[model samples]
Target: MNVNGTLINYYFHCKRQCYFHGNRLNLEDNSENVSIGKALHEERNKCNNTEIEIENIKIDKLTKEYLIEVKKSDADVEAAKWQLLYYLKVLKNKGILRKGKLEFIEKNKTKKKILLFELTEENEKELCEITNNIKKLILQDDIPKVLNESKCKKCAYYEYCYI
Candidate 1:
């Protein structure tokens, strides 16, 4: 599987998470997040003017050039941002978009706006390094051990890693 920039950023956030999710591991038990996200996306799709599910990217209110991503948890925020960033990077690389705004809807209510920038050469380089590191870790089949620290209290994979 060719890992894209989105997955690369995810890898940076947590190697074990990236491995479990990227490799299609059957870890998550509930689809509540998926269902909620789909509903929100369907709402955005209702707008006649808005391009709904264009290719791999979904543009909410296309006229406004806004990308809407619904998050069920704060833990998903970072990965969501990286996904938006990857979309922006692809758009810029293909000369389709110069800039855009990222709107993250939290728990079906709160909204936060972020400006997506064109990925700089340095940013790409750093992402590449992270990607390589993640690939190495995954290929080695080494699941990173939990540090049993305070940070684990908030990790989505805390339960899985702790054991």
Candidate 2:
């Protein structure tokens, strides 16, 4: 199975969520928050034509020097960061190289948020290791324990995990 951006993000956010995703138990369709995020992505990218799809990954935008990811919020910056980094790795494997840019449109009340990232030797190595771990975790018969229930309220798999 190909590890897409969603899996990478979910792996960072919640291992249980990642396992559920890898196992094809999708609950995002019943998620209001997920719908809003999808709408935000579609609305924001409608005017921009840089978005592209590669394998199981969807890049929000790509410029000459950067691969940009536009997010509705910065609530989970770490997950977003790793997701973007994973995209960079996929591109690198195809012989392309570019810097990573994360754009959080609704983080601060007024100011727009943007962070830049680059994949280094260390980061690439770590990501590979993480990817392997994720694959193994997802294949296990048991679901991972919830790490934080407070964060579950905003999760797409909230009901699946708690209810």
**Overall lDDT per candidate, in order of appearance:** 0.57, 0.89
lDDT of 1 at 47: 56
Whole-model lDDT, candidate 1?
0.57
Q: Estimate each model's TM-score.
A: 0.64, 0.94
Off by over 4 Å in 2: none
Model 1 sits at a Cα RMSD from the real structure of: 4.1
RMSD of 2: 1.3
Please report the TM-score between candidate 2 and the true structure.
0.94
Clashing pairs in 2: none
lDDT of 2 by residue, 1-163 (tens): 7788899999988899999999999999989999999887887778776679987789998888999998888889999999999999999988889999998889456877999999999999999998999889878988888777678998888887778
